[model samples]
Target: MENGILARRRRELITGAVVLAALAVLPLPIADVYTRNLIIITLLFAGLAQAWNILGGYCGQISLGHALYFGAGAYVATLLFVNAGFPPLIGMFVGGAVGGLLALLVGWPCFRLSGHYYAIATVVVGEIGYLLFLNWDYVGGATGVYVPFKGDSWLALQFKTQKLPYHYVTLAFAAAAWFAAWLIEGSRWGFAWRAVRDDVVAARSLGVRVFASKMAAAAISGFFTGLGGAIFAQYVGYIDPESVLGGQFSILIALPAVLGGVGTLWGPVVGAAVLMPVSELSRSYLGGSGRGFDLMLYGALIVVVALARPQGLVSLLGRRRERARAA
Candidate 1:
């Protein structure tokens, strides 16, 4: 059994390396700025989705208001960089720390409730945060803040003429998120989280500190999510409440994990790879019509995927592998 587990771990690591290598070179041949930008956005969301999965998938917290952490990260990093001349490379870590702390704060009360009630509580908390940021003049309020150009320094994480750097940055972030998930999946916390997810009563009876497990998952999830948000704020160079802290943004964060395969490592990446391109393309080509056609198409695709592959697209990969082994 030990040898089998070690062998599987080695295989997973090898597979991850190959995938990362392919992604690293993917944008090299593509000259289209739009295509490269799309890839970056996809990678960013993949990381965010994986982050969400740590709590929502593995821990079964089902939070609908992750935007709070995301927005908090963006605001913290942006504020530090713009006001104090702090480098965003370091500010992002600060943002992530704030995000993790904020998650614990939010989880403290919300975790008392279970199932949909907890989810609803999160949405309320998230909306309250949005409202606060929108009204608070300290963070620029509704006017939003623009990340200034301070030459093309990597310390600032600003690349004026090149999109390639941002691509690599997001790719690294996504890779890091994946690696984190891989580590967590093999940890004792992972086992406890799965037990809690499967049945809270059973988990508690088995002497698992259910609350601690959930809280740990939330902190880790929020940290990575916030880091992703900081990267996004830097990449776009502008952020507002509607852009970062809105309810829709929460849905966007959770959708990939749900569509890919909750509780599975590869699920978020697969879902993001499929969803982001379709969304970008649909919005680009169909959004011009302005009759809500783009949204309609996007909604239809999601519904189709949900109805057709309820277990998520990642399940297809498992089935294929099983068939190959059988052959």
Candidate 2:
């Protein structure tokens, strides 16, 4: 039975790898600059979604304040690169460290709260970060900071000629984030996180350090998200308080988690694949026409999904897969 299970798992892994390899490469053939940029942004947000999943999904902590990490990552990397003349690759790690530290600082206090109080604390922490970013002129404040455009320095994280580079780079980050999630899902740490998520008191009774597990989750999540933010800032060639640390940024991060499946490793990627294209299409059709069609569509989609499938897309897909297997 164990051998059979291992064989089945190997088959599943091989199949998934083939599909993802195809998705990553095949899109290049038909990708115009516009489409390439769109997909890159989609992948970037997907990475963020997966990072958020670590704390929010695995740990069962609903944090609307992930924008703090995302924004901090972007700002720190951008500031170091543009102002301090630091290489972006090094800046990325530094930004990630900052984000991880911030996560520890915030999570240490907020994790003590239970249920809605924890949620509220996250929101407050995010708001504080936003306010500071908005007022801090050293990093462009409300106006924003523009990355200096170098001719062709890959080291500077600047690619002037093609969107293909951006696409591949962002895809790499997304793949890494997904791989990390998969590794964590089957590890001892993952089991502990799930235990704490299910019942903190029970987990504590069983000798699980609930706070430490949650903090570890937060740290890992922040690192991935911060790295993604560095890529995002470089792609945009600009970063600002409003664009980097805003509520919209948080929404973009969380929407995939909600749409796809919160707790599963593949949920964010699947969610981004399904939801992002629709959103982009809606914007193209309904945006800037003095109509709220896109907003209406988003609202409708959320309502329908919530009413019909509260467990989310992953759960729905799992049910279908089981039925097919049984048949």
TM-score of every model? 0.98, 0.94
Top of the candidates by lDDT: 1
What TM-score does model 1 achieve against the real structure? Answer: 0.98
> How well is each residue in 1-327 modelled by candidate 1, as lDDT tens digits?
799777887888899999999999999999999999999999999999999999999899999999999999999999999999999999998998999999999999899898999999999999999999999999999999999999998999999889999999999999998999999888999999999999999999999999999999999999998999999999999999999999999999999999999999999999999989989998989889887898898888788889999978999988998899799
Model 2 regions more than 4 Å off: 1-12, 325-327
Candidate 2 on 199-297: residue-level lDDT in tens?
A: 999999999999999899989888887888888898899988888788667778888888888888777887887778778878888877758788778
Clashes of each: 0, 0
Relative to the true structure, how large is the alpha-carbon lDDT of every model? 0.94, 0.83
